[model samples]
Target: MNQAVQYKLKMALTINWFCYIGLLVLFAVWNLFLEGGSIPLWCIQTLPLLLVLPGLMQQRYRSYLWLCFILLLYITTGIVDVMMPTRGWQDGAMLVLSLILFFSAMMSSRWHRLQ
Candidate 1:
């Protein structure tokens, strides 16, 4: 790709990550101080996952790898809850979202292919 195109994509990706983070913060405020819905909590809790896009943008393999480990634990806990049905069906939803977040992050990163 040409430098100009690469620069534009990078900018767009950066803006996207910022939007994700900003949304997460908004969700956090909402969940903690306002609505407190399951979806809001989901967004707040998973907000940290937004870091992966920027990490990918910078080609920070170590950060990406770290988030993968974190994602593993998150997914595992969600799966356990799903199997046991501790917090109702939301557990399964959490698990599914975790998987989606991990998948999304990896895919958004292009699995190191973007660089």
Candidate 2:
């Protein structure tokens, strides 16, 4: 295995949580203008795994399962939110998540390749 790959795999956990925290902030943004205040399943499900993908990819078993649980809820929550996000901030939040997800995934994959 390349040292690069090892290094990248190491960072997966951090990236995952960074994304999740970003999502939480996004939710807070939604709170400002939305009338309904229930979180969707997609947000709940995907939020977690996205948080842990870094460690999971590296085979960090301790929190992999926990991440999966979060991912599950995020996925469901995201779907529901998509259908009906009362808060104005939801859309922006999704856009940000999309960008973050794209960048993180790309960078990590490249890092793995370099290793």
Candidate 3:
């Protein structure tokens, strides 16, 4: 990959990592406190993010590649949540963030492969 593309990929990956984590934290907080969601259920819901977090922090290309596939669950959740009347905005945010994360991971993986 070109140096410029590599740099952009790095930035995108970083942003995706942060955004993904942030979205999870935000969701947890919103559900736990605001919506009175169950604690155990919340943990279960966030488990996928936790599972992939180490790889994300390590900046592994293979991890990013896999994460692209794993993130589909989140995308589907976002789509379902977006259909609700009350939390549509938050879900829309998740949908957008998931898309960003997906695109960034895809590009990052491709760029790393090129390297």
Q: What lDDT would candidate 1 get against the real structure?
A: 0.58
Worst 10 residues of 1 by lDDT: 104-113
Model 1 alpha-carbon miss at residue 25, Å: 7.8
Q: Model 2, stretches more than 4 Å misplaced?
A: 32-60, 84-115
Instruction: For residues 54-99, write the lDDT of model 1, one tens digit per residue.
Output: 6756766465556656678768877787788346555565566566
Ranking by lDDT: 3, 1, 2
Question: Per-residue CA lDDT of candidate 3, range 2-73, in tens?
Answer: 889878877986888777887787678757976657788778777877777788788788888788887898
Candidate 2 per-residue lDDT over residues 8-109, each given as its tens digit: 666764675577577666665555345654457446534554566577557455444454444444455555666674634565466556455545555555
Between candidates 1 and 2, name the one with more favorable lDDT: 1
The alpha-carbon deviation from the true structure for residue 101 of candidate 3, after best TM-score superposition, in angstroms, is: 0.8
Off by over 4 Å in 1: 2-61
Q: Which stretches of candidate 3 lie over 4 Å from their true place?
A: none
